[model samples]
Target: DAMVIQNPRYQVTQFGKPVTLSCSQTLNHNVMYWYQQKSSQAPKLLFHYYDKDFNNEADTPDNFQSRRPNTSFCFLDIRSPGLGDAAMYLCATSRDSRWQTYEQYFGPGTRLTVT
Candidate 1:
């Protein structure tokens, strides 16, 4: 479905060696984002793309990276993961253009383990 968040739920994660997950929306929202969530934790914005515009959280680790070369495709690249890196990777998008952060939907997460 368009204008919706797929896989809005996820599993608990443990300390991690490396893990990567994904999300996509058919709505073609101009802004797309990836969030980090720990077990029993709140979702945290890792990074997002505003139609080829890349924005990263100040505290986000260097191990985390992203790419959006086209309108409908984006990727999350985790160079190296640590125990603390074990968390949900959420993909989301917003309809608003001209750089606005609005309400978003979530995707089912990929659980990771650090062992």
Candidate 2:
């Protein structure tokens, strides 16, 4: 089974328009996280949910939101795709299977381009 998958490995959007990226996993972990990376730099945590406990990064914008309706699926919704929003959207998960350690495994990422 595919542990983690992201659709549309690349995405292009017009500035100020809404865009969305999807992520799914079979790892069956309780916690799911979203991150944004630019220019191949370190992934910046946007926000995450720990079985319903929502956590947002300090730098995350109001335009970005996430939804995890169930354990196997999650989504990132960017209400307004800005020119700066043109970056890589990464979906990652930590194996909450072991309460002792929580290490995040990242997907290949969805690259976003602004036109």
Candidate 3:
């Protein structure tokens, strides 16, 4: 089945250290999204890139960065992870972002740990 896959399903990083989480898809979708979901909170859209256009949510922190090198792969880089940054990082893809019913295919998220 076509799906999104995340690497290093569990990640451990020291405080203030940099960590990179990767996501790749087999669906050949045009849009990719990154979300952060903390304990007991709804997933918050961090950013997304459509083709080569990157769009970031207003409230997303500066430390969170994303790169979509190609149609099938995307990476989320945390420049400096703080203890509060510990959360599940999710990657999702959709065929197109302009559709009202843009249903996304999500990967099993990467859980980040900051010491």
Candidate 4:
């Protein structure tokens, strides 16, 4: 089945170390998004890519960054890991249309643990 895939379902990193989470999809969707979700809190939209265009949320911290080199793959880069940054990182893809509403499909997510 064509769907989103996230690597290294669980990751452990030392404080101040850099870590990268990856996501890919076979669905060939035009829009890809990254979200940070903490337990018992609402998921926060970090950024998204619509084709070659990149959009970042105004409140997203500078520590969070994303890269989409191609349509099928996206990367989330954390410049410095912190204990407070430990959370589930989700990757989602959507097909936007003027004719109909499209739903976003999310991957299982990558759980990050900062020591």
Which pairs clash in the backbone of model 3?
none
**Which of 2 and 4 is ahead in TM-score?**
4
Residues 5-111 of candidate 1: C-alpha lDDT, one tens digit per residue = 43424433334434445456677777788887787888888898878889999998898888877766666766666766766666777766555647776556555
Cα displacement (angstroms), candidate 2, residue 97, comes to 7.4
Model 3: lDDT of residue 24: 98
Tell me the lDDT of model 2 at 8.
Answer: 85
The lDDT per prediction is 0.68, 0.88, 0.94, 0.95
RMSD vs true structure, all candidates: 3.5, 1.6, 1.1, 1.1
Q: TM-score: which is higher, 1 or 4?
A: 4
Error of 3 at 96 (Å): 1.3
What tens digits encode model 4's per-residue C-alpha lDDT throughout 21-91?
A: 99999999999999999999887899999897999999998999899999999999999988999999999
For residues 18-94, write the lDDT of model 3, one tens digit per residue. Answer: 99999999999999999999999998999999888999999999999999989999999999999999999999999
- Clash totals, every prediction: 5, 0, 0, 0
Order of all candidates by lDDT, from best down to worst? Answer: 4, 3, 2, 1
Better of 2 and 4 by lDDT: 4
- In model 1, state the lDDT of residue 69: 70
Assess candidate 1 and give its lDDT.
Answer: 0.68
TM-score of each: 0.77, 0.92, 0.95, 0.95
Give the residue spans of candidate 2 off by over 4 A. 97-99
User: Model 1 clash tally?
Assistant: 5
